[model samples]
Each structure stands twice: as structure tokens, then as C-alpha cells.
Target: MVSFKFIHTADLHLDSQFKGISGLSDGIRSFLRESTFTSLDRLVELAVSEQVDFMVISGDVYDAQDSSLQAQLRFYEALDRLGKHGIGVYVIHGNHDPLDSPRMKTGKREHVHVFGPEFEQVTAYRRQDQRAAAVIGGISYPTAKVIENTSLRFQRDKDNSLFHIALLHANIDGDPAHETYSPCTQQDLIASGYDYWALGHIHKRQILHELPHIVYPGNIQGRSIRETGVKGCYVVQVAEDGGVNMRFHDLDTVRWFHETIPIDSIAGEEAFQTQVEERMQEISRECPGKMSIVRFVLTGRGSLHEKLEEGRIAVELLHELHRRAIRSASEPSGLAGLVWVESFDVRSGPWIDREALLKEDSFLGELLRYGQQAREDMTTRAEVLRSALNPLMANRELRMLLNETDDEECAGWLRRAEEMAVLLLAGEGGGESTDED
Candidate 1:
């Protein structure tokens, strides 16, 4: 019964630029730029503190086409720290950091072993006895577009006595959000007969399988609002009985949060503002000792909806929220108690009985019927819209923006469209009594 422990992490994306983030304060922007490095530093600190047998970084170590010298140096320094502590490091380059990319002049330490473009194996040892603890097999992406099923290439070691772990940066079964690089499936991984599969290339942490422990520790830090919540790695311990235990450790210096505040019941401008402040305070308590970027969605029917719809009110509310965040940051604790509102969306509708509006034989009813039809036949409508918009999206710049627009963005646009239709139709003076005037 050989027991050993190791840290599994990937998608460091060092020095990566954040997307969809603009008009931030200079201090926050600088903090965001340094977040990746800070996350990697914490990972190294964790590794050293845990004194694990070895650390395996599945891929995407850095995020530039030409790897920045600062990122490379910072990475090397962190590895050197692990080397100093006699902890071994195993790494494979993902799409962001391909094998052909410009190499760093400062060489890696002896304890560090980077898998090459082809499938390779490295035997990690128990630090004290130098006994073979685990056999790690992995392959680095030679270029960014290696769409082959690299997982099938992995062959289990003949010596079944030592624990076998496979490291890869791949999109399993084609996740639409990510590029299909080194594509493979769960069956492919399971059939490979590896004791553990440490996966990368996906920003969200997931456990694809549990029997053999196929896992993605996710990126070390969230770069955008899309990558929300706590981002970190996993510490996996293999027991003497061949059972595997894994635990997640949060390493993000700054967190991203998306919160929805239902303002349906709240009345009056002052009360609404107070509610917003209370929500911010609640988030501040939840994410204590961490700076958070929050996207607050104000939803549900309420009297304040019309007030919020006014451009000036929204602007004033945003300003107030910003001031609150700045004031919190200026406290003795600094950024730790901060909660910056990256954006606020007013999605509330007028406090009208929607069912009664639909029952009326008026323009509002017709509009509601059209909306219902569109939703009921969503697939067909989506296809029609996609076909119509294909020409516009064909332009490179337009395509880039379209690509950045996730499902949430598309939904938001649809919601706004619906609201606009409702507002226009409901304004008709001839409509029968749908609600109080």
C-alpha cells in the first residue's frame, strides 16, 4: 500500500489580459493584470506548505502568443521556490504556451520536468527515499491547433505497482465555449487505464469521472465575469488501498461574482438605494479579505422599475455604488473589504399583471402572443436569426465580438428586446383595463 500526495492545477494563464473589463479604476486594473502571477505564487506557496510528493500543471501555463518575459521569469521563480523545497514539478504546455513558442532564457530547475510535444513519461519519487511514487504520462501541444485525440496515445505503464496519472489539456466531447484542441472523450480517458486523469483547457472546474478520478482543477484565477466564483486547484491523495481523495483549495486573490437582487417588493427611491447598499454589504461579508468584481442584476416587477429605467437614475446609482466600494477599500483593511460593481443591469418590469395584459384583446396581447411563439419555436427562430445575421458576423471584427458574446449576453439582448416591445405596445391609449392607470 503506497500512499502519496500531489497538487493538480492548470490554466495559470499568466499575464493574460482580462476581457469585457473596461473603465475600471487604475488601482483595480493593475491588480487584475497581476492576478495571474499572484495566483501562481499562491499555488507555489501551497505546494511548498503541503510538501506534496509532486505538482502537475496540466497546461496553459502562460497566455500570450509570444510568452512575456515577465510571466516566464515569474513562473520560473515560483518553480525555483518549489525546487528549493525539494518538491517536483511536472508541466505540459497548452494552446496558449505551445512548444514552438519563444523559450525563456532562464533555464528551469532540476526538479522540474516538462513533457514534450509527443507523449512522454516521467517517474516522480518519494522525496525522502527516492522510491518511484508515481508514473506521470503527458503530451504538450506542439502547436496551438493539434486537434487530434491525444488521450488515445497514452498507454498505461506495464508496472501496475506504481500509480499512473495522465496529464492533458483537451476539450472532452467538444465544449462549445472552448476551442476543440486535443479533443477526446471520457471513454478514451477511462480506457487508458490510468489511475488518475488531470485535465485542463476548460476554465470551469469539473470532475468528469470519479472511479479513476478524471478531473479538471480549472484555471487558478477568474479572468472575467464569465469565470465566476472561487477559482483554484485540487490536492489529490492516493491512499494505500488504491482509493483517491481530492480536495479543492481556493487560490484567487480577487474574485468575480454575479448577483441578482429582486427589487419587486421594495418601494421608494431611498429604500431601493438602501437595498442595493445592503446587497453590496452582504457580498462584502461573503467575500471577506478578497476584492470582488460584482455584476448586479436588478430583476422583478416593482414600482421602482420606471425610476430605474431613467438613464440619470441608473448613472447616479452606479456612481453611488462606486463611491461605496472606494470608501470600503480606503478602510484600514484596504482592498480586502472592497466590492466593486463592474456593472448593474435594470431588468425590472412595471408592476403590471402580465396574465391580465395577455387576456386583453389589444396590441399588448398580440405582442405577448408573438413573444410566446418565438419562445415556443426558439430553435427555428434562432436558426432564422442566425442565418440572417451570418453575413454581418462574417466580418472579422464583427465575428470577434460575436464570439465574445456568450449565452448570457444573447439572453440579455433578447430580454431588452422583449421589454421594448412590451413598453411600446402597452403605451397604446385604447387598450382595455389591464392594470391601474
Candidate 2:
């Protein structure tokens, strides 16, 4: 039995521009640009420390097809360091970095093996004896759009006694969140007769299967709020009996987080503000040494819900939080910015006693009753409204002027309209009948 150890990582996306998120300070913008390279440096450091046999980068080594010279140089520098340790590298270009993409002229890179445009097999050699340790089969995207199932082309020799691994930058089972590049299914992989499948392309990490271990190590860094949480890679050890043991390692220099705060427990505006600040502190503590880019979502009913309904209130709160974050960064610890608010959303319902309002015989009671009916028939009303508006949207000019409206947006509009009507009809107190009032 031949035992081998290796690191499986992908989606380096070196030098990602991060166009998805905006309205950031210059400091944060600069940090984001250098983050991928920083992650690469950490990856190299981890590989050397772990003393693995080889590192297989599944794909997307660069963020774009025409990668910048700085990104290429940084990548080569990391590879060269791995080479110095006699650790090998197996790489395949993903849709983002295809065969036709412009690659830097780094001369001959030692101990680096990259698969070509077609499915083929290669070997990671044992350093001391130069013996074949693992048979790796993989393919690169020819020009970015890989319409076919590239995994079907992967073949392994059943007669061989060596450990087999398949590396691919494919979207298994057509993940709706990602493009269907090099698309394949779990059955396709299982039929290929490989001991392990190292995958890439998707930015979220998960294990798809086991026995013949199937894994996705995700991307090295979080580029946007959409790609939040811990981003990293995996180290796998194949035992003498063909059993596999894999462990994950963190590689992100800065992380992204989305936090939702329920406002139901808060009694007033002051308490609500305190809760927001407290949550920010907690999230910042969760990521002590690294910068945390966070998106906040406020939901559930409370006394402050009515206050948040004013268009400028949420905006004011967001700006206040931003100022607090800036202060935290400039404080005596002298660390760079630690927390940033990506976006703040207030989606809580109004804090009104509907039963009491409905008991009243005035117009406000009728209005509340009508609003209740609309809420109950929200789906039917949304469909009716969309049906009426679809014909108008069919016109090219109107389509250009107006955005498409989904059910959620329609419901929100109806809710806000009712809330506004209540505020106007019920006056300053908003016809309060709460226990405290």
C-alpha cells in the first residue's frame, strides 16, 4: 500500500477587482485588492508547514483570463517557494483562466505540472525516491465556455495499484448560483473510479460525497459580501489501505459576514441602536486580527419599527455605524479598519396593535381591516398586479424606464403604503393602545 499526502485548493482568483461591492473607503479598497495575494502567501506558508507531498490547485488560478503581471509574479513566487521544499504542484486552468488566456513569461517553473486543454493524466512524484505517488487526471477549459461534461473524459487504469485523484474546475449538478462550466453529476464522478475528486469553481466549501472522497475547498479569500464567511483550503492524507483523512485550513486575510438582528426584544430607539452596536462588536470580536466586511439585516416587530419606517432613519443609522467603525479603526490599538457595513436593511413590521385598531369604528379601523385582508391575500393580489403590469412592461421603452417587479417587492410596497396611511390618519401617537400607553 502506498501512502501519500497533498493539499487540494482552488479558485485562487488572484487580484480580484471586487466590482460587486462599492462605496468603500480607499483603505478598504486597497486591502481588498491585495487580499488574494495575501491569501496565496498564507497558502504557501501552510503547505510548507504541513510538509505535504504536493498541492493541486483545481482551477481559476487568476481572477481574470488576462491576469495582471503582479498577480502572475506573486503566484510564481509562491510556486517557486514550494519547489524549494521539493513539493510538487498540479494545476488546471478554470473558465476564468483558460488555455488561450495570456500567461506571464516566468520561464521554466520547476516541480510545477499543469494539465492542458484536454483530459489527461499526470503523476505527483515522491521526493526521496522519485516514485509515482498518485495518478492525477484533469483537464483545462479551452476558452472559458466549457459546455460539455469534462469529467466524463477522465479515465483511470483499474489495473494500476497506485492511488488515483481527479481534479476539475466544474459545476457539479449545475449549481444554480454558478455558471454551468465543465458541468457533470455525482454519478459521473463515481463512475470514473477515482479515489478522490478535488473540485473548484463554486466559492462555497462543502463535501459532496465520501468513500471516494469528493471535496470543494472553495476560494482562498472573500471578494464580496455574497461570498461571505470562512474561505480556505484542505489537506488530505491517503493511508496505506486507501483510506482518506482530510482537514481544512484558513487562508483568508480578511473575511466577509452577514448578520441579522431581530428587533422584537428592543423596547425603543435607544435599545435598538444599542443592539446594532453590540452586534457589530460581537462580529468584530469573532474576527479579531482580520478585517470584517459585514452586511446587516434588521427584522421582526418592535417599538423602533415605526421609527425605522422613515426613509432617512435607516440611512442615518448606517452613516452613524460607519463613523463608529472609522473611530474603532483609528483608536489607540492602531490597527487598520476592523469592521465595515456593506449595507443595512430594515425589514421589520410595524409595532401596532391590530386587534385594538380593528375594534374602532373610524376610518383607521376600516383601513387596518383592509390592510389585514391584503396581507392575507398577498399572493393573489401580487399576481393580479403583475398580470396588469406585464403588458405595459412588454413595451421596450417602458421596460427601460421601469424595473421588473417580483412578488416580494410588490408585497413590501403594499405593506409600506398601509403603514404610511395609518401614520397619517392616526396622528402623532399613531392611535397607540399598547399596555404602557
Candidate 3:
């Protein structure tokens, strides 16, 4: 029986979409971009601390057409640390880091083995005293497009060749959410006869199978709101009796969180603050030391809707929380040390400008009725409402045709389109003439 462990992670995406770092301070943004290395360093630290036999990086080491020299050097430096500790490293290029790219170069290391585009059958043995070892077979993305399933390429292990593990970077059977690169199915993976499958490409952590374990470790850190929450890798422990237990290890340098707090009876900003604090308190307890940048969405209907819908309140709240935390030195150290509120979108059912709406025959009331009627006029409301507000659509004939619309059923149609048009006009400049400008 051989008792050993390994770390699995993918999609590091070093230096991805750096242009959007404008909101962060120059130093902080630079740190965040370079923090991919920091996450990897944490992985290395974990490996050494745990005395893991090896580490496997599935793919996407960098997110660019060309990997930077600094990136390469930094990667090797981390690997060099692992080497000193006698930990082995195995890497395979995925869709983002294809084998044919000039950005990636093959190098030799006593503690490292990188699979090529072709199936490379290899085995990692337990320390010399152990009687058995695990066999791993894998391939890399040759070019960008791998239309056929790559699982068919993996050959079953020879008799008595130890536990078989297959590593590859591709989507398994058309996940619409992921890029269609080297699409293979779970059935294909099971049929391949590998004891385990280490996958990459999808940023979300998922387990596709358990019979012969198939898993994606997810990205090491959340890059944006799209890739939210506590990011990390997996720690796989293979027991002496051959039972494999996988645990997720949070290795992110920064944290991204999205939370929806229901405001059924919120009275004011104090209520909002209380709700937000309660949510943050819970997240802090759950994620501990993660630098939680949050989107505290106030959901449901309540009296506090109008105030929240106003300008910059969410940003102000986030900034204030961050300031308060820093000033009082009351932050949770387990987090990565930043709390930014990304956005506060309003979805409450409360009506805006209620007092104006109660005033009969008032402009606000008339507009409200018009909106409700327009929305209800499912048939011609879209076009009629568009023509009504858009001065550019002010062909006198069309406006007259639109103005003739008087049915109360058309309220919903007008409301929806008018609201959309209001937003469009506000951003692009009001009316058809301004749109042309």
C-alpha cells in the first residue's frame, strides 16, 4: 500500500485582461495581476507542508497570445522551490496554452514532466520502499481546435501497471457554457479505463464522476465577477488501501463574492447597513480571511428602494465599509485584504415616485398609466412607444399614429420600452437627433 497526496489546479490565467485594472490603484492592480504567481507559490507551500508526492497543473498557465519571459521565469522559480523540497511536477497545456505555440517551450527538470500533444504514457511510483505506483497518461492541446474527443487516444494501462490516471485539457461533451475545445464525454472517459481523470478548461469547480474520479480543480483565484467567490485547488489523498479523497484548498490571493440580501421591510440606510453587515459577517465566518469584494444586492420590495436606486450609494457603502474596517483595524486576517462593492442593482417591486403617482392627472401619474398600458399592449406597443419618445422617429405621421394609442392594456408595453428608452437616451443623449449626433 502506498500513501501519498497531490495538488491539482488549472486555469491560472496569468496576466488576463489587464486593461480592466483601471479601477484599482496602480500598485494594487499590478499586484493582483502578478498574484497568479502568489497563488502558485501558496500551492507550492502547501505541497511542501503536506509533503505531497507531486503537483499537477492541467493548463492555461498564461492568458495571452504570447507568454511573457517574466511569467516563464516566475513559473520556473516556483518549480525550483518544489524541486529543492523533492516534490514532483506534471503539467499539460490546455486550449489557452496549445503545444504549437511559440510562447511555451519544453524544458527538462528532475522533478518535472510535461506531456506533449500526443498521448504520453508515464508512471509515478511511490517511494522505492512501496510495492506499487500510479500510472498517469495524458496529452496537451496540439493546436487550438481539437474537434474529436481526445479520450479515444488514451490506451488502457498494461497489466500490473499500477493505478491509471489520465490528464487532459478539453470540454467533455458540449458544455454550452465552456468553449468547445476537444469535446469529450463522461462515457468516453469511463470507457478509456483510466482510474482517474484530471480535467481543465472550465473555471468552475465540478466533479463529473466518482467511479473513476473525474474533476476540474477550477481556477486558483477569481479574476472577475464572472469568476466569483473563494478560488482554490484540490488536495487529492490516495490512501494505502487505494481510496482517493479529494479536498478543496482555498489558495486565492483575492476573493470575489456575490450576495443577495432580501429587504422585505427595510426602513432606511441603517437597515441596509445591518443587512449588509449580517451578510458580510456570515461570509467572513465561512470564508474566514478572504478579501471579500461583494455585490450586496438588495432584493424584494421595500420602502428603502428609492434611496438605493439613487447615484453612487452602493459605491459609497463599499468604500465606507473598507474605510471603517481599515481605520478600526477590525478586518478578518483570513481574507486577502480588500472589500470592494462592485454594484448594487435594484430589483425591488416597490414603485418609484409613489407620491407623484397618487396625484391624479399629474404628469407622473399619466406617464405611469401610459407605461402600464404600453406594456400591456403586447402587439404594437414596442414600435408605437419607440416612435413616441424618439424625436428622430418624429415623422409627424408616425407620432400621430402613436399618440392615437389609448388602450389601458398597452400600459405594460409602454412601461418596459419607455424604461429601456430612458436608459438608452440617458447614456447616448436624448432623442433621435441626439442619437444621430
Candidate 4:
């Protein structure tokens, strides 16, 4: 039985900075731009060492609009490196890098064969001991927005004689919140005659099927907070007997990790600091990688409410997290390759308030209740707004605006809503002034 391995990956989003609220420093800016490429370099090394037969880059090699000439050149160089070792690279353009986009460029790598905009079929021939084996079929995004179902193209390939495989990019009910790219259903993939389907566009790694073979290698690297955890690729092996095995490799230069440090039973700042330090240690233990960028989320109900209420305490906690990160970096601790604390988020809420808040007639109490209700309803005000606006924001332009705007813009929207409420209240002739009411 001839066993061969191939690396499957997508959504590099190279040369894009982390979409952080705060401004990025020079170091981080460079890190963000170079990290994905670095990870790809590592992936190539791993593939060569592992003697992978071929590599499949499902899609999104760069950020949608910001793919640069240099990035293209560097990508070609990596492909050429693989080609030098007799490794063939098969690829298809994803939503971010559709076929018609002039900005996207493919370097001069004869060994690399990228599928065009249309749903094309290509046969991969392996000649061993005068015997030939073939795997056929691949798909691509024709335009930026593909509303129609694309998986229909793969259905006929299911029962083909040669081992059939499909390379596709879509948001398969896996993430309903994401833009409905190619709007495919899982059932379509299952019914397809193809033995394996290599998917892209979703940035989180997942395996959908084992019987007829369906897999998403996920993004090569996580570009922002929205894309988290150990970002990487997949290695799939197909044997002559039609047996398949799949495995994922973490190739991120800087790992983005979300850690929830519960402040439930914690006390003073000293104890808090200890708890945080211990939590950091635990994270390092869990993800033993290089240059880890963490978002430490202080959660749960506890005495932290009072401490967190004090702005100084909050600031101190942030400083302390950085301090611990620095110390961990300087010393040879279990942090291993942990490099920085990209940012820290504290989702703290007041469990107890002034007696006035409990009184329904009290204004301060009403405000507190409203705020708590919003929090209780959704994790954060942003989440609430996202849910409320999701339907309207389904429009690409509106979604882009929402993604680019911040809390200030959201506040303006809230103010407009409040004004409308006030006008309605006045029309009802409630006779109570907003100030007095």
C-alpha cells in the first residue's frame, strides 16, 4: 500500500495586524505582519522533514484587501522552496482571495497549480511500480460574494473510479454568524462522490466527516482576537487501500490564548496577584509554545467587584499582569516560548450595590438594574449590539461599518435610540420631565 501525506491549510491572512482596540507598537506591528509567514516557513520545514507528498493551501493566503507585493513575493519564494524538493502545491482562492482579484499574485512556481475561478477538475497521478493512482476535482470562489451553493459541483465526483477529493471554501453552517460564503450545507458534502473534501474560510480547525472524508484545516494563523488559540494546519494521509488518516500541527509564531482567571474567592491585590500568576503558569503549562500572547480575562462574581470598581486597582492589575509576563520572559520558567501579553480583559460586575439600587423608584437603582440586565442578557454591551444589529448588518457595508466602529459609535446609536424613546414618551403626555422622572 502506497501511503502519502499532504498538508492542508488556509486563511493565512498574512501582513495583517491584530485588530486590537489599543494602538499596536512597532514590535507588535512587525510581529503581526511577519508571524504568519514565519509559521508558513515552519510548516514548509515540517512538511519537508515529514516527507509530505504534496501540500494543499485551501484559501485566504493574505488579508482581503491588504495583500502586498512583498507578501506575494515571499509566498512565491516559500512555494518555490517546496517545489525544489519535488513537493507539489495545490491551491484554490478563498473568499478573501477570489480568482478575479488583480491584487492577488501567484509567483513563478511551475510545481504549484492553483485552481481558477470555475469549478475545475484535475487528476493527481502517482506512478509507482508501473501502476498509476489518481485523485481528481477542485473548486474555487469566482467572486467576492458567492450566494449560490458551490458544493453541487462536488456531488458527481463521489462515485468516481479514481480516488476523488475536493478543495472548497465556504461557511458551512459551522459559523452561522459569519458571512454566508458559498452558503453550503453539510448534507451536500456527504452526498458528493468525493472521498475527501478540503475546506477553508473558517479560521477555527474542525473535522466534519470521516466516512467520505471532509475536513477544514482552519486558518494558518490567527490574525486577531476573533481568531484565537493554537492556529495551524492539517496533515492528511491517503493509502493505496483507500484508508485515510488526518492530524493537525500548530504553526503559529505567537499563540493567541484566552484565559479566564476566576476572581470568585480571591481577596486583596496580593492574593489576586498570586492567583493571576498561578493562572499564567497554568496557561504556560497547557500551551507550551513560543511567544504566547495572552488575553487574561478576570471573570466570575467575588470581592473583586469593589477592587475592580476602583480605577486605580484596575490599572494596577493590568500593570501586574505585564510585570509577571516580563518576569516570566526574563527567567527560564515554564513559559517556554511565551513572549507577550497582547492585552488583558476584566469582565467584572458589581454583585452588591447601594440600597438605593434595589428600590424600583430610585433613578440610580434603575440605571444599575438596566446595566445589570444588559450584562445578564448578553456577556457584554458589544455582544448585545452585535446581536441586535446582526440582521441589519447582514449587508456587507453595514457589517464593515460595525466592525470598524467602536464603543463611541455604538454610544451614538444608543443615544439616538434613547432620543426616540423620549419622544415617544412625550407623545404619550406622561407629563414627567426626564430630569424629575
Candidate 5:
């Protein structure tokens, strides 16, 4: 009987640019820019403290083909720390950081074992007694265009005594958001007969199987608004009877969160501000100790919509929320923690009941009906929009943004337009329109 422990992680994406985040204060931007390195350092610290036999990084050690030398050096330094403590590291390159990537650097440390473009195996030893504890099999992408089923190449060790682990950087199935590189399937991995499967390429942590323990540890940190929540890795323990135990460890330095709150029940501007503050408090409780970058979408029909759309309330509210977050971060009480509003969007409609308004034979009813018809006929609406937008399309940037006006997005535009029309009509009827004009 033998037992060993290991840490499984992937998609470091070291030094990747944080996209879709703009107009942030200098302090916040600096924190975001250095968060990736901080997360990796925390991971190394965890490995050292736990004294795990080895660590497995499935892929994407670097973000792009032109990863900075500073990122490479920082990664190597972390590995060197692990090496000093007699810990081994297993690494593979994903599509983003393939073997042929011009910026990928060769490791100078003896403890780091990087898999080649072909399937290969490496043996890790237990710290207590330098005996072979497990056999790890993995493959790296030679170039960025690898589309073969790399899992089929994996083979389990014949020795039944030692644990077997397979590391892969692939799209298990086709995911529209992700490029299909090194495509494989669950059935393919199950057939390999490995004790545990460590996967990468997906930025969301998921457990695809349990009988043999197939897991994706997700990425070390979130690089964009799209990649949200607690990003981290897994610490797995294999017992003598082959019983596998796994635990998730969050390593993200900064967290991203999206929350939508209904404001229909609230009345004045003061009440709306209070509601947002309460939501921020709730977020603080949910994500304790971590800096939160949140995007709040206000929803539901309400009188506040006109005010929200008219004045500089949204901008001022965001600044106040940011100040609150900073104050919370610095406070010793920790009653309200650090939570910054990255963006605040108003999706709320007019206070008038839409169904009731539609029944009336007034101008507002006709306007509502026209808007509904346009929403249903998106193709026709798009043509009309294109005609009006054609002159503005001369600007390359604006044209690029409108290149792919999908059906869903078009529907959203129509809905917002309808809401605005209702608000305008309500204002004309002396229903308290807060339009600045």
C-alpha cells in the first residue's frame, strides 16, 4: 500500500492583458496588472506549505506567443522555489503557448519536467521515501494548430501498484467560445484507464467525472469580465486503496462578479442608492477577503428609470461606491468590504405596467405595438438600421463593432428602445419624466 499527494492546476495565462476593463483608477489598474503574478506566487506558497510530492500544470503557462520575458522569469523563479524544497513540477503547453511559440523560454531548473509534443511519461517520487509514487503521462502542442485527438495517444502504466495520471490541454468537446484544439471526448479519456485525469484549456472549473476523478482546475486568475468568480486549482490525495480525494483552493488575487438587482420596488434617488449599497454589502459577505470588480445591472420597471437615464446619477453613484469600497478595504472593522463597481447598467423600464399600456388605444399603445413588431422582424429592422448606420460605418472602429449583429443582440436593442419610448411617453403625460432636456 502506498499514498501520495499532488496539486493540479492549469491555464496560468501569465502576463495576459486584462481586456474590456477601462477608465479604472490607477491604483485598481496596477492591482489588476500584477494580480496574475501574485496568484502564481500564492500557488507556490501553498505547494511549499503543504509539501506536496509534485505539482501538475496542464497547459497555457504563458498567455500569448509574445509573452514578456518578465513573466517567464517570474514563472521560473517560482519553480526554483519549489525545486529547493525537493518538489517536482509537470508542465505542458496549450494552444496559447505552444512549443514553437517564439516567446516560450526553456527551463533552466532540474526539478521542472516539461512534456514534449508527443505522449510521454514521467515518474514522481514520494518525499518520505524516494520511491516511485505515481506515473504521469502528457503531451504538448507542437504548434498552435493542433486539432488531433491527443487523448488516444495516452496509455496507462501496466503496474497496478502505482497511481496513474493523465494531463491534457484540449477542448473535451466543441465549445463555441473556445477554439477546438486537441479535441477529445469524455469516452476517450475514460477508456485510458488512468486513476485521475487533469484537464486544461477551459477557464471554468468543472468536474466532468467522479468514478476515476476527471477534473478541470480552471485558470489561476480571471483575465477579463467574462472570466468571473473564484478562479483556482485542486489539491488531490491518492490513498493506498486507490481512493481519490480532491479539494479546491482559490488562488485569484482579484475576483470578477456580475449581479443584477431589481429596482422596481424602490422610489426616490436616495432609496435607489441605499439599495445599491445593500447589494454591495451582500457581495462583500459572499466574497470575503478578496477585492471584487463587479458589474451591476439594474432591472425591472420603475419610476427611478427616468432619473437613472437622465442625470449623472449612475456616474456619481459608481464613484461613491468605489469610495465605499476603498474605505471598506482600509477599515479595521471589516463591516463592509472592498467591492468596486466596474460598470453600472440600467436595464429598468418605465413605471407604467406594460401590459396595461398595450390595451389602451392611445399613441403610447401604438408606439409599443410598433416596437414589438420590429423586435419580431429583426431582419427588416436590421436593414432599416443598416441604412441609417451606413454613413457612420465609414469609421472603421464603429463598423468593426457592428460586424456581427447577432439575433439575440438585435432583440436586446429593440427591447431597450421600446423601454425608452415608453419612458418618453410617460414623461409627456406629466408622469414625472427626468430627462435632462
Candidate 6:
């Protein structure tokens, strides 16, 4: 066995086109579109700085079924840069970039080795000593949908003297968050007896086991709000005794954040605006040199809730924040240091005494009681609530973007609806009775 160091990254998703994000200026949109490439550049820079022996990309180097010539060339060029540094690159294709997809031709370089549809074995050699470092086993998806378990077919190269690594892109144990392509279990992987498993296809970074080091480095860049937070890869070093050490390096050029501001105690509008400004300033310091896409969720009951929807206060505040962000990004401080306010969601409700409302004998009180009952019995109410909102759920556009509502999600929506109805529909005369009786 020999000492070695390498970077393990997956789901580069180069040239990613974002979805469900809109209302951006042309300049901002261009910046958003170029973020994936920026992150890739950063990843390459990290690899060179760390002086890794090699780099392993588990899957999904491209974002589309058919990779454009420009993307292919750019990817090849990145590998050429690695070649200059005496770093070898091994790549596998996932469901997103299956080997069967038609791709534009790019000049092949000697440093980059892309796995084919079947299982293959490759080896990484240390540049300084010309000693064998590790033997890597990998396979690629023949097509977008691989029903069979690809992990089962991987046959280790029978060279146990060196560190053995398995590279795969799979939905481990059929994770519901992603499509169940090339599904396999942890037991199956441990049985393979590989020293390290570099996995892809799940954007959330997780370490399933440490004895043999089964890990998911996660996507280098998050493409949507659903994939929020800092995204990056791992740098792993193996010692002569075969002790594996892995550390995460943040390479996401643009970050995604969902922040909730509770305004239950705040009464004045000036105070509310002050709170928002302070939070924004604090968030700017988090990832100092990267653009942050933020979605502000205003939660908790307050006087501000009355103005949020009725007088278009929420929308107005969102626009004012957007202007501030634009001004900051355009300054000499740099656009990368600014926070982009992606959206503002008003989930707060008007200040009201729930105990008093429950005690009243009015129709509104009766409705409130039933709503609570239905919410409590979510196991049975989920179906009924979904059926009642069938028209909205059936909207073709909604179906394309969202998944079927689960019980917890359905219950939360029901709760929000109840709160909103109590505040908005209760007339001005009704308000004299109690915060809208």
C-alpha cells in the first residue's frame, strides 16, 4: 500500500439551467446561469492547491441528456488543466448523463478516463514515486433508467495490496427523494469489500459508514431552492497503514439559504424593517465571497400580518429588499459579496387570542374547532384534504414541479389555510368582537 490523496466529487451538473426561479434582472439571470461553471472552476482550483494524486467524479458531469459541445469542451479543458498538474481524472456517468445519450465530440485528452456502460477497473499512480496508489472499480449507466442494481455487478480487480475504491451513482436503498435508479443497499456495498465508496445521486452530503468509509460528497452546486445550503466535495488522504481521512471543501460559487423571521412580538413597521436589515447584513458575512440566494419566510403572529397581505406590504417589502441587494451588488464591494433576495413568503397570522376564539359560540368558533380536530387526525384527514384541494393539486403545472403531498405537509397547509381564513375573511364589523371573531 502507498500513501495517496485525491478529491472525490459528484454531480457537477455543468451548465445547469435553474427551474422555479424567476423575476430576475437580465444581469442577475446571467450570473445565476454561470454559477455552475464558476463552481467547477473552483473545484479544479481546490484540487490543484491540495496536490491530489487523482480526482474521482462519480456521476452526472453534465446537466442535460445531450451535452452541448461547449460544455464538453469546457469539461475536457478542465481535465487538461489537471493533466498539466500531473493529476489523473476518473469519471462516471449517472442517469442524467448516461453513456447512451448523444454527445458532441471533444478532443480526448490522456489524463481523463471516462468509464463505459460496463464495470471497469482502473489504477491511480503517484506522480513523484511512480508507485501504485489505489485500484478503482466503477461502472456507468447505459441509459437514463437502469432498473438493475449496478453495484452487484462490480467485480473488484483482485488486487488487495493497494487501496480499493468503488465509484457509483445510485439511489441507496431506494431513497424516495430521488429516482430509484441503480438501487442498492449498504449491506451490498460493505460486502463488496472496497476500502472506500465514492457515491453520487443524492445532493445532501452524508456518511453512511466509517469502518470502510462509504460516503456521498453531494453535488458541487445546488440548482434549486429544494437543494439548499453550502455544496461541495471531499478531499481524502490515505496513509501507509491504510487509514482513510476525508474532509469537505466548500466549492459552491453561489449558495442557497431559507431563513425564517419570527415577528410575533414586534408591533411597529419600523422595527420590522430594522430586523430584516440586520438579518440581511448578518447573512452577507456567512459566505463572504459568494452570492447568496435567500427566501425569507415571515412566521409567527403579529400586527405586521394584518398589513402583509391586505395592503400588499409583503410584496412591497420584498421589492425594497431586492433594490437594496441590487445596489450593494453593483457597488465596488463586488456582486459575489451581495445577497440576492429570491422570494418573501408571508406565513405569519394576525394577532388573535386563540383561547377566546375557541370559547365563543359563533359559527367561526365552530369552524375553528373542526379545523383543529381534522388537523389532529392527520392519518385520516390527509386524503380528505387532498381531495378538497384536488383542483389545485390537479393543476398540470403544479404536478410538474411538486410531488404528491405527504401527511405532514398536508397538515401544515391545512393549518396555514385555517389561520388565513380567520384573518382575511372576518369582516371589519367582526373585528370589533375580538381580533376578528
**Clash count list over all predictions:** 0, 0, 24, 6, 0, 0
lDDT of 6 by residue, 131-222 (tens): 89999889999889988888887655564688999999998977777889898999889888888999999999999998788899899988
Cα lDDT of model 1 by residue, 283-347, tens digit: 88998878888888889987777777776776887887787666656567678858887877877
User: Superposing every Cα of model 5 onto the true structure, what RMSD results?
Assistant: 5.4
Give RMSD to native, each candidate.
3.1, 5.6, 10.1, 7.0, 5.4, 3.7
Give the per-residue lDDT of model 4 (tens digit) for 303-350. Answer: 665566455765766666666555655565534555455555655543
Local error of candidate 2 at residue 377 (angstroms): 15
Residue clash pairs of candidate 2: none
Which pairs clash inside model 5?
Answer: none
Higher-TM-score candidate of 2 and 4: 2
Tens digit of per-residue lDDT, candidate 2, span 1-437: 56778999999999877744665666667777888998999999998988888999999999674499989889998999999999999999999988888886667776998899878888777765677888999888889888888888977788887899999999999886788888899999999899899999999999999977889999999887778889999999888898999999999978888789888898876787787778878877887878888777777767677778775666777788777666666567633437777776666666666688898766778777876777789665666556756888879988765564445556666676777777676766546545652
Q: What TM-score goes with each of the models?
A: 0.92, 0.83, 0.74, 0.78, 0.83, 0.88
Local distance difference test scores for all models? 0.83, 0.82, 0.71, 0.69, 0.83, 0.82
Residue by residue across 1-437, what tens digits does model 3's lDDT show? 47777788889876665322234444455556766777878888888888777788888887657477777777888889988977777888887777776664647787788898788887675543434467778888887777778889987865744677788888887876678888889999988888778888998899989978999889987886667766788999887667899989888877777788877777878778888877777776665555556666566656665466564656678677756655433333423444555656554545344344435454444554665655566555666755656883458887676565444324534444454444444334232232232
Local accuracy of candidate 5 as per-residue lDDT tens digits, 92-165? 99999998887744646778898999899988888768888888899999998898999999878666557889
Q: Which parts of model 4 are misplaced by more than 4 Å?
A: 21-25, 104-108, 127-132, 157-159, 285-289, 320-336, 351-437
Candidate 6 TM-score to native: 0.88
Q: By TM-score, how accurate is candidate 3?
A: 0.74
